[model samples]
Every structure is written in C-alpha cells, then in structure tokens.
Target: MDLQISVFLLFILFTAGHSFRCYDCLGLTGSCANQTVQTCPSGFSQCQSLTVVIQVGSITYKTKAKDCAPFCQSGSINFGFMKVSYSCCNTDQCNAQDAPDPSNVPNGKTCYSCDDWSCSNTVSCSGTEDRCIKATWIAGGKSVKGCASKSICDVTAFSNFKGISCCEGNLCNCEGNLCNGAQSITQSFLFLCCSLLSYFLLH
Candidate 1:
C-alpha cells in the first residue's frame, strides 16, 4: 500500500510540473494565420480548435479559434442558423490546424429559420444536422428556429435554460411557421443562452 501511494504521488507531481503548450489564435474569418505558442495553465490537458459558422439570410460569417482546454470533446453543434465544430489534441502545440469548414451537401432536411420578426423562412439542413431547435429570446419575446446536429441537443448542454428546446424529426421543434408567436420564455433564460454562446465565442 505504501509503495503504491508513493508511486501515485510521484506520478501526480510529474504531471503537475509538466507544462503543456498549444497554438493560440482567434480569427473572424475562415482561417487563422497568426498563431502564438501559449503555455496552458494547470488542469488544461488538451489543445482545442473550434470553427463556427453563422448564417443570417444571404449573409454568412465564419470564425476560427484555437486555445487550451481542461478537456474537449471532438464534435459538432448545429442551431439551424449557426454551426460549431471542435477538434482536440493532447500534445504540445498540437492544435496547429484549425477545424474544417462545415459545409456538407444538403441532407434533405429543412427547418424554419428566423432572420427577422417572421420565422417563416426555411433553410436546408446539411451533414449531421439531424435535429430541430427553437430558442425564444425572452427579452424580445421573439423566437428563432433552425436545424441542429444531435450532439448540440444533449440534455446537459442546455439544462439551465428554459427558452431553448430541441427535438428530433423534421419540423418537430414546433408545428407551424408562426411558432415563435406562440412560444414564450423568460428573460433570465435568454440571458443564460447568450452567455453560453458568448463563452464559445470568446474562449
């Protein structure tokens, strides 16, 4: 027992004393050109790169970011109008490559999208976007709908927010084009959703 305890202590000390490095950069465009070596803080065991795409009507914006994370799950999140993809590695400067753009051919699924007050518009779902999501902005009493990947619909992802709901099947988040008019949410719930979105954007 003593020998095992001592070995465990030595292993912990070795890991704690080791410094991990990663390529760090954030860009509003599709690619990140300038990357700096960043020494990760303790508890951060992996390097991560994330790509996000937000589409509003005919306009589209994409951003790429690289940083250190305590832990990261490689996956993708889709919110009809927005999409996020993540990649992770466990070695020094391993996040040298940014996540790829998520532009898969349309997968024949369609869902309502809200670019303005009218949530009547629809967009095609692509790739792994197999779910429908609706989120109400409590402050504005308005709701937005879109196609999402099943990964983003995990219960733990939005457990604290009541304004957001995700469902499986086509147009399953709501039954009609004017679904936003009938749904209601609290301001606090929207705030939490925005904060969660911001964390992904800034971090």
Candidate 2:
C-alpha cells in the first residue's frame, strides 16, 4: 500500500509540472486561430493579430495588424463547429472568416502574407523570447519580426521584463525603429541585469 501511494503521488506531481498552454493559442503564426468574427461591429470581440504578405517576383511586402477581432465583432457568427469565423480579415486562407477587402490592398502587394511558422504556442517561463517583425508595414506582405512569433502585438512576457518592448528580443537583428535604434538601451539593460552574474562569477 505504501509503494502504491508513492507511485500515485509521483504521477500527480509529474502531471502537474508538465501541464501548460503555449504562448500561442493556435494557427501557424499564433494569429488568433480560435477567435470568431462579427459584421455589425456592435461591441468588441476576442483580440487577434492580422498579417499579410505580398510577393511579386523577388521583392516582397508585408503588413501586420496589431489586432483585428475587435474591429469586426458586431457581425460575428458561428460556422458549424468551433472553427469560428476568421472572416474579419479578408484572405484566401481565411474562408469562413470575413477577410479584409482585397480592393483595399495597396499597390505592389498581395492579400495573404504570414510568417510565424516555427512559432509554437508552447508556454515558456521567464527567459529570452523570439522577436519577429513583418517584412513591410503593408497589409500582409513579407516580414521578419525575427522572433518565434511574427507580430510584435501578440507578444507575451513575464512582468519582470515586460517593460522591454517586444521588439527588444530580436535575433540576427537589423536596423530599424525597434532594437537596432536602441543599442544603448540594450547594452545598458543587459549590463544592469547581468551585473550580479558578472560580479559573482568573476569574484
């Protein structure tokens, strides 16, 4: 009886430690795949990201929406299952959803562009996270937020470091209004955060 009880306790502990929901809810880009759409714009809906990538030959333009669901919550409707209507933003990829009007598309652009591929909804504890940006500011073009997730809007971080901009965690980093322009801030913050590590280890 004692051995059986111990085994059961161990299983419970393991299970509790392993259960978690990722930062991303769903969709290849963590762009609010579980949200529904609206038509009349009565109130607000679940917040979701919008991204578009346009590729013509070699050059590509990208656009990302910080949020979209709230803009179309009035006309939201249930399809059949829990698939939910993503019609808020018009795109070939979004069938049941109210996609943004393609006519609104700017010159030199496509209507469906998203780049959050390897991004896992896998929840993570306090630590460095990926920071990616779309290629262009246009509607769903081509972008590289350079993070596990594409848009900077859907970023999730602990309160300890949430003060930093989502663009702060970028890798391969390039020149831009994000991190590249704030080199001094990055270095200063790093030094402050690691001062203890440097002192303790060196000592």
Candidate 3:
C-alpha cells in the first residue's frame, strides 16, 4: 500500500511540472496593460508576445498578442509597408510585459514603391528595415517594390509573388530602372490589456 501511494504522488508531481501557468491575450490593439493567467497546453514550451505594425499609406495600425509558443524566439517581419515584431520567453507569465513599438526614426535606407501609373515612387526605410525588395506577380503581371526589414526580406512571406528580389544598398531595387534613396526605423509604446486565452495553437 505504501508503494502504491508513492507512485500516485510521483505522477502528480510529474503532471504539475509539465503544466505551466502563463498569461494569454490576442488580437489586442494599443496596449497589454490588463491580462489574465491560464495553464499552457501540452507541446507549448514557452510563453510568447507578438506585436505587429501595419502601415498603409498614412494610417498605421498596431496589434499586440500573448500566448503559448512552440519555441522562444524574437524576430521581425516587413512586407511591403507592413511590419511585424515578436518576442518569446519560457518563464511562467513572463510574457506579461508588452513588446516595444516600432521606431519612427529614419534608418537612411531607401527603396522604390508603386504608385498609380508607375512603380518608381521612393519610400524611406524605418526601424529595423534595412533591405530593398522588388516583387513581381506572374499571373497578374503586377509588381510592387518597397523597403523591408532584413528578417522579412530573407523569409518567403509571399508565395504568390513568382519573382522576388532583394538588395541591401539604398534604392537598390532601382539599380537597373529603379531610383535611389535611404531608409529609416521606428517603435511604439502603449499598454492596453485584456483577458489572455490558451496558447496551445502555437505548435
């Protein structure tokens, strides 16, 4: 009987160790000042915080989210004019802190952007963006050129764009027919919190 009791206690301890309590939130705009706690599901190894900044023309939108992540990593993604930055941690409720906003200062990098009748418009790079990208769609015969973060330029974020090219120099996208310019970077800081949900979908 003693042996049986010891085995049950060991199982309880193992189960407790595997389950992690973390803060969860999603699709939050502005800030993450208010949040709730929940147990992370199996297969999730870390708590995560993701912040995305999407800019279209002059209007910029931000989204903040926290949940369980498969791994702990911090990186940024920039596509066209939209940019996303994320950070992940392994401690319980470690994601409680919000991510910093994208910087607004210019980084002295430049690239071409598309306009009504031409793709020769110039765009300034911002924040961690340091690459110039030129993407052409084979089916639609459309092309878009803009500045991007190094991480986003390296990743295959757009599978639909059949022809994609990236360069590191100012206005490098315009080397042959493109123009010349520099780039810049920026960040934001706002804390708007809400209830955190489970992070099991991070796998």
Candidate 4:
C-alpha cells in the first residue's frame, strides 16, 4: 500500500511535467472541471476541481467539488466524490420551470441505479439505477389530459447509463472492467480492408 501511495505521488510530480498527456488519460474520476486527479493501478484517484455550470432560461446554476474521492484507494475502491450539475433549459414554447431544487435532487427524481449491468460503484445518490427513466412534457393546458397519455417526457431520460452485461456465467464479471465486447471486437470489415490495402501496396 505504501508503495502504491509513493507511486501515486510520483505520478503527481510527473503530472506537472506531462500536463497534456495527463489530460487524455483522465480516469475513473467523476466528470469534474479544472482539477488534478490521482488514482492507482488503474491510476485515477482524485478529481481536484469539479466545476459544473448549468444555464436554465433566466437562471444559471453552477457548483464545484472541493474534495477527492470520498474514501482513499487503499481501503475503498467503490466510493468516489464527484460534483454533479443539472440544469433545466427553456424550450421553444417553454421557459425553464425548475432549477434542481436541493429538496428535490441531492437524491433527485431523475437519479436511478442498476446492478444487473455489473457497473462499478461510481458514486450515485440513489443506490442502484433504473434501466429507463423518461418524462413527458406538459403542454399548455389546465388539466392537460391523462398524465399517462401525455406523450413527451418533461425531463431527460436516464437510461442504459452503462452498456451491455458480460460475465463468465458464474465465475467473473470482468466484462465491464476490460473493454466492452462490442467496442473491443477485432474481426471487422475495416480490418479486411486494411489487410487488402497492405497487400495491394506491396504488389
């Protein structure tokens, strides 16, 4: 563990020198803004500044994170500290109706969880998540008909945050950790084209 900490600190020093490369390899840290993050093994443990700004009609909402992941790497790998920002914008015929009322969203109506996806504990308000969450718009009306048949969702849908599920039947759930089966594919039409290109050039 001490060795890991030392390695992390050393990376911190290197971060000062290889600033641009550090930006690209940004890891499991919550999507924060203008902060330095450090994690080990996979190697991203902290997100220094998480600046989130949301513009909603007449009101603009902004917040920042001043802490690293909730727990240290040695003892905990699931707990993460991240800044979350959500804004309600105005549509063509609608103005921003809500501004993420704290009473509503430290655990919001939209926040959800899903364990079947075998997702990593990336820090969420409501434990687990929903597969599909949709909201319908409220058109200009007093009663506005049936809430079920309303048609459009008022809020953005939070569905399938993580991708497909993968596992070894009963042994391991390494699919999510490594590259997903879909994107990690090697056999493809493009591969065939590249192979043909090399052969054609040699000929």
Candidate 5:
C-alpha cells in the first residue's frame, strides 16, 4: 500500500512539473488579437512570439505568430529583403506580447546580392545582418546572394534552401567581387523564418 501511495504522489509531482500553456495564433499584421490558450506538449516548455517584416519595392508586409515551442531563443535577424524578431518565455501566456521589429539602421556591413537575375549588385547590411549568404539551385545553378543575420544562418533554418550556405567577413559570399558564383569552403545554418514570411504572404 505504501509503494502504491508513493507511486501516485510521484505521478502527481511529475505531471504538475511538466505542464505548460501558451497563446497560439498567427496573423498577417504586427499582432494577433484572437489568440487561444493551448496546453503545450510534454517537451514544449517555452512560449514563443515571432514578428516578420518584409519590403519589396514600395510595399511592406508584416506577420506575427505566437505558440508553444519545445525550445526557443530570443533574437532578431535582418536580410536585405526581410527582418525577423523572436521572443521566448517559460511562463504561461508569456508570449502574449508581440516581438519587436528589427532595427533598420545600416550596420556598415556589405555583401554581394542578386538583382534581377544578376548577382553582381552590392548591398549594405543592416541591423543584425553580420554574415553573408549564398543559395544556389542544384539543377539550375541559379543563385541568390545577400547579407544575413547570424541567427538566421542556422543549418536547420536553411534546410529548405538545400544548397544554402553562409560565411562571415564583409563581402565574403565569394572569393572575388561580384563573384557570388562558387561555393565557399565554409558553410553554416539558415533560419527558416524567411520561409514563414513567404508562406504567410502567399496564403
């Protein structure tokens, strides 16, 4: 009887310690107004909030998402085309607030960037974009190059881009100026938050 009682107490303690909850919602604008509380899965111990802003020519788009996450790191990333910011917390409903926008001020870093199918254009990096990124299609050989925030250079983040690679140093996307042509020896990760922006914009 004592063993049975101990087992019951242990289960109650474990269950109480593992439980977590967060707000879950996604919106096209800077914030989500209609969020619902959701119990997180066993391994999900953090509440996450993400904000993405993208610019194309004269227009700009913003997206926000909040949910329970297994793990999260608060940070921001800036690519020439888009900027993303994320915040995480361990308490219930802690992600109710929106993540802040990434800084727009130029950071004085530069890299080769693609413009209208041309990879020779120079682009000034801004905010947290301290690394250079190069992504090439395996079959087509077509490539895109630009500056990226270090947080977005995670391997798991660039998995969708396949041949995507990142490197450090100014104008280091390739060995020569305007030569975003060959793959460099160093490679790193990419954040898929950019893809999230694309998905939200498309659907």
Candidate 6:
C-alpha cells in the first residue's frame, strides 16, 4: 500500500511540474520561416505571433516573432506609415501560423510628414491612423511630423523628445515647423522585449 501511494504522489508531482511548450522564432521579414519548440516559463498562459510592417515611400520593412507570452490579447495597431499586428493562443504550439498581412487600402485621412527640410510633404493615412503628430527634440535639434494611429498617439512617454503634440483633421501635421523628436518608448520597448524573449527562448 505504501508503494502504491508513493507512485500516485509521484504522478501528481510530475503533472504539476509540467510546463507548456510553444514555438519560438524571430526574424526580419522572411527569416521566421523556420521555428523551434520551447518550453514556456511558469505562469506564461499563451503563445503569441507578432508581425510589424513599416512603409516609407516605396520601401517596406517587415518583422516576424513568436514566443511564449503572458496572456496577450490579439489586436492590430496602425500608425499611417507603420503597422503592428499580433495574435495569441492558449494551446501548446498554437502560434505556428503566420499573422495576416496588413491592409493596403487608404483610409481617406491625410497628414503632413517631413522629408529633408520640408515639413509640407503629404502622407496618406491608412487603417486606424486618425491623428497628425508633431514631435521635436530640443537637445538633438531634430523634428518629425507624421500621421499616427490612436494607440501610438496615446503614448505619453517620449523620453528625449519633450515636444510632442497631436491633433485630428487632415493636414494638421503641417501647421507647425517644429516637429516631434522621437518615437515613443512603448513601441521601442515592445520590439526590444520581443527580440529578447525570442533570443532567450532560442538560446
């Protein structure tokens, strides 16, 4: 009877210590085609796939990432020239599928962007971007004006770029010569965190 009880307790402990497995990978554009399995850390509740696309003029940049995430809700954020989309699933290895491509259809909103010394250059807004943003950094003597989605515009921490302002309506970004300095730390942190997570999971 003691041996039987010991065996049952061992089984319980083994099940309790089990961790979820997820696919993990990271790459720029097409590099994520190959992925590896990873054991999720304790308390991580979901597997996630994230895709980011940035379009400037005729050039496009893309990134793909997958890892064990802490219960992230799936959604998309569009900032006129940039877009980020993410999907999460609770099942093991459910993040194997790729994220869908971002929509290219113009959303009918327009804003001003700076190129070289020109702040009057027009930028066509797409997706959920509905605000014109102007950010400037006094120390760096840099400024930028562009269209942003509600999510990106809502980020309050600009770090070195103290001059940050946003407005709704077409061509609102061209009203001022002083431009917004830097992108929000939140977006940078998001990308950095995902990169680190993928690195740790792979190594």
TM-scores of all candidate predictions against the true structure = 0.66, 0.18, 0.55, 0.19, 0.66, 0.53
- Each candidate's number of clashing pairs is 1, 40, 30, 20, 8, 7
- Put down candidate 2 lDDT per residue, 8-86, tens digits, no spaces: 9999998766421111122324243464333323233333333333333465333323232323221111100100111
TM-score rank order: 1, 5, 3, 6, 4, 2
Relative to the unseen true structure, what is the C-alpha lDDT of residue 166 in candidate 3, on a scale of 0 to 100?
82
Q: Relative to the unseen true structure, what is the C-alpha lDDT of residue 32 in candidate 5, on a scale of 0 to 100? A: 82
lDDT of 5: 0.68
Residue clash pairs of candidate 5: 152-191, 153-189, 153-190, 154-189, 154-190, 155-189, 157-190, 158-190
Instruction: Give the whole-model CA lDDT for all candidates, comma-separated.
Output: 0.70, 0.28, 0.61, 0.24, 0.68, 0.64
Give the number of the best model, judged by lDDT: 1
lDDT of 3 by residue, 1-203 (tens): 99999999999999777678678765545676667887887777788776767565687777777777655445543443545566667887788887666656778887777543455677777777788887763334455577766654664533334466789988778744433223211111111101011221232
lDDT of 4 by residue, 49-166 (tens): 2223323345544343333221111110011121122221211111112112222122221221112122222222222121112121121111000011011122222111112232
Which ranking of candidates, highest lDDT first?
1, 5, 6, 3, 2, 4
RMSD of 2: 19.5
lDDT of 1 by residue, 38-92 (tens): 9998888899898887765688878898998886756565555667777878989
Candidate 1 residue 143 Cα shift, in angstroms, is 4.6
What would the TM-score be for candidate 2 when compared with the true structure? 0.18
* Of 4 and 5, the candidate ranking higher by lDDT: 5
Kindly list the per-residue Cα lDDT of model 6 for residues 1-203, writing each as its tens digit. Answer: 99999999999999888789888987775457889999998788798887777665688777787888765546444444555566779997999986666556678988876554355567776666677777763333545566665654665423223466778988876553333423332234235334433432342
Q: What's the lDDT for candidate 1?
A: 0.70
Candidate 2 Cα outliers beyond 4 Å, as residue runs: 1-53, 58-95, 101-143, 146-152, 156-165, 168-203
| TM-score for predicted model 6 compared with the true structure | 0.53
